[model samples]
Target: MTDETWSQLLAGLTNVTWQSLVMIAVGCLLIFLAVSREYEPLLLLPIGAGAILANLPLSPLVGEHGLLSVLYDIGVGNELFPLLIFIGIGALTDFGPLLENPKMVLLGAAGQFGIFLTLILALLLGFSREEAASIGIIGAIDGPTSIYVSGILAPHLLGPITVAAYSYMALVPIIMPPVMRLLTTKQERAIRMPYSQRQISQRTRILFPIVVTIGVGILVPFATPLIGCLMLGNLMRESRVVERLTHAASNELANIVTLFLGLAIGSTMGGEAFLRPATLAILALGLLAFVLDTAAGVLFGKLMNVVSGGKFNPLIGAAGISAFPMAARVVQKEAAREDYSNFVLMHAMGANAAGQVASVVAGGVLLALMAG
Candidate 1:
């Protein structure tokens, strides 16, 4: 090869700009958060790596025929990865906690209060109706739901929305604690919720996914795809005969989809896409969205506590934010901080699980409101 050929081969290195370096540093910080802080490592690590790879000048990981580009076209662009991931989430999820105490579903619906609240805020900040609606969904705290909603309503903002959604989700353990403590007193936090030893029949468990899929589909057709995939995975797990499928969906399929989803999202974090005033607004609104969700859940929990004559611990309400086991675990930890034997984890799980379902419904409602 001539000297000109050597220069052409090294163009990526030669053309590296200061902006790219800044983006690379940001990616490194994400990696550090994954490795040292152990914050959503599975997502942050891959996403961080993808950001670094994509930010390189003339990145081979983007554009037509690029590996990340192909992955995006295959899944993220078509909005398949999030749905696939939901299947895995359903396969791994335990709905028994939710089924035992159906009342927890109320907290789940209450938790979605922030999404609409934030939608107005985003609109006030100059985002269009569709953009504001997409931005508001960051409160869902479920990564797939955020991706699914944003990809539909405002695809241009998907990058920042996805980042804000996932990052705030990882921060749930932190964001929830102060709010939970502030909202409930020591006496309230010490309130104990008796675990329902009620057993859910195998038949009921098997019927749940089918019933949910049908009911939710009929009610909000926009939600059918999201709810359908999720229930399908759950059905596979509940069937008992499909143990192999369940295991694969929960493990192999989930892991692979997570990686691809992470890379696709990170690829969107190109220097031009991410380092903008709009990106900053998204991150800010996302934090507010999560905070508001937790607060709404806790306030409503407090109201229920009053109605139940102190039978309810307001901390359980914080678990209603669709953060899954993490939010539930946080509620349990807060309770344990007050009383070691204050075992409300199961109850919290019920609410937390309800939030999981309610969040998707809320997303569907948003879609119907905006697109329909």
Candidate 2:
């Protein structure tokens, strides 16, 4: 072969490294999980694509002024993307269930016990106080909350924490049901809480976000930005006149921000940065927090059951950790196994929605406790 051709072949072969190859494999695995296993396709697809691009030899995606770096600087670094995503979440969420059953708020608060508990555990394990606090928010089981808190308190760990939070959130259906069933009796699961689909007027719905933002802001000032943006989107959604804006926030805006956010987050997973014992520990601690949150929710449900003369199903308590509709659906399905006619979707949804708000509040509280 000519020296020019031989040199070109040798150069190509020299560019491949074990680290880059492993990262490419990991990226492919993420794609498989997202596409075939149907696990958080929206975020995982972008993350996988970013990882692949970043790992490619001589790729500019993670270089200065590169696409991933620019996106990260503009959004993740400034904590804009997560807040934007929160707006979309607010626009999409129906708070009617939570408003209809205000008492479920207690279950939501109870579900956050795991955050403080995990904070202590992480501290004992030798993580810095800020890092521990950031890790503890994993128990909130709310992706935007986790991202927001960690972004401010511990940006370096954002990739693993974000990935862990979303992955566990997706697994809520699988993780919660068995725990719910084990904690509640068959009779309890069979107890029916029929849906009362009250027609919430547009005025009431629009006012709900404003009222909540004011109330929560007064109580937790640090949560103002996250809560305010979220509530603003909700208000737009319910105002009955901002249909175009609401649609954009909930769909196009959300989709664009999600892509940028995921790519930027995944780019942070360089081998030297991610291949650490601390990352592994963070992963384990995240799972621990999730389990503890589930346990606390179930226990609180049992307490409610006792106080209400068996009217409340303890299984619904397991839905109170902000995994949202997945946790709620798991509770409903588990209840159906005991008695096919029993439908607890509304009750579970109440707890689920309350859990969502509570998780965000808990994230802010943890920040206060740690930063104070």
Candidate 3:
């Protein structure tokens, strides 16, 4: 072959830069974290693979009409994937425990305190209002919600925000245990929350989603889209008439969207755009947001515990950060550490579920504030 043809064929290798090499290494690191540590392999693995592909020069996968590019445009760009994922989440969520103990919603709201706090921090650090709002949402600890909010408010920062959000989400088991221990006494951790089984009628369950959809939609207006889809999935599951649809939404649909969502998110991790000072700032601020979220939730739990005469277990506060069953399981583990008989998983799940709702509401509030 002619030298010109050879150079063209080896273009990707010949034109490779240090930045590309670094990003490829970072991709390997992501894969390592997924495989070795089991840190959200479903998300991290696809994201890591996509990152490596995107970093390669003249790579077709990230260019126009490329698989990753098209995926991003169809899924992340229009903000469809996260909403679809919400349906599956809603289908899986059970609000019974939350309804039985409505007060636990306070813990959910408290968990999101970090989003606003971090907003101010990001503003102080010279990020624009929209950008700061997007940055602050990393505190939600719900990857889809973070992506949805940031995608709308600051598209440029989506890649970093998503990485921070999901990375910390996977580390929830690691990050929250210490916070729970530090913030509460052993006795407080052992505090038993007697499960008060409340019978919620099918009517209540059906009406619950409708009521929430209308109430939150009217209140936060911007939250309508996120909450609406979530409720739709819940409605489908609770109705029980659409068994096939519910099962599909909760499993197959969720899986397909999640895979594409991860790849789309990773495709945006081009080193030229991603490797910057702002990216580092986002990483630091994301951790700060997580710390602040856990702190606020635990402190709120402590206050509630005092008011309730020590009936509340502060460990449940860590569940308020919306890592879903993972946070609830961690709370249960911490409770088990104190006394094996203490089963706060239901209560923790309640708070964790509430955190999911609160985070979306918080995102809407941020959007409203910025829009105003």
lDDT (0-100) at residue 98 of candidate 2?
Answer: 86
Tell me the tens digit of each residue's lDDT in model 2 across 14-90. Answer: 78777778777877888888999889889988888888888887677888989999999999999999999999998
* Per-residue lDDT of candidate 3, residues 65-141 (tens digit): 89999999999998999999999999998887788788889999999988989999999999999999999999988
TM-score of each: 0.97, 0.94, 0.97
Tens digit of lDDT per residue, candidate 1, span 1-372? 999999999997898988788889989998999899888888888888888988989988899899988988899988999999999999999999989999999999999999999999999999999999999999888899999999988888888898788888888989999998988899999998877579999999999999999999999999998999999999999999999999999999999999999998888888877888998999999999999999999999999999999999999999999988999999999999999989999999999999999999999999998876
Q: List the residue pairs that clash in candidate 1.
A: none
Question: lDDT scores for all predictions?
Answer: 0.92, 0.86, 0.90
lDDT of 3 at 41: 91
> lDDT score, residue 63, model 1?
93
Index of the highest-lDDT prediction:
1
Model 1 lDDT, residue 313, Cα? 96
Best-to-worst ranking by lDDT: 1, 3, 2
User: How much RMSD separates candidate 1 from the native structure?
Assistant: 1.4
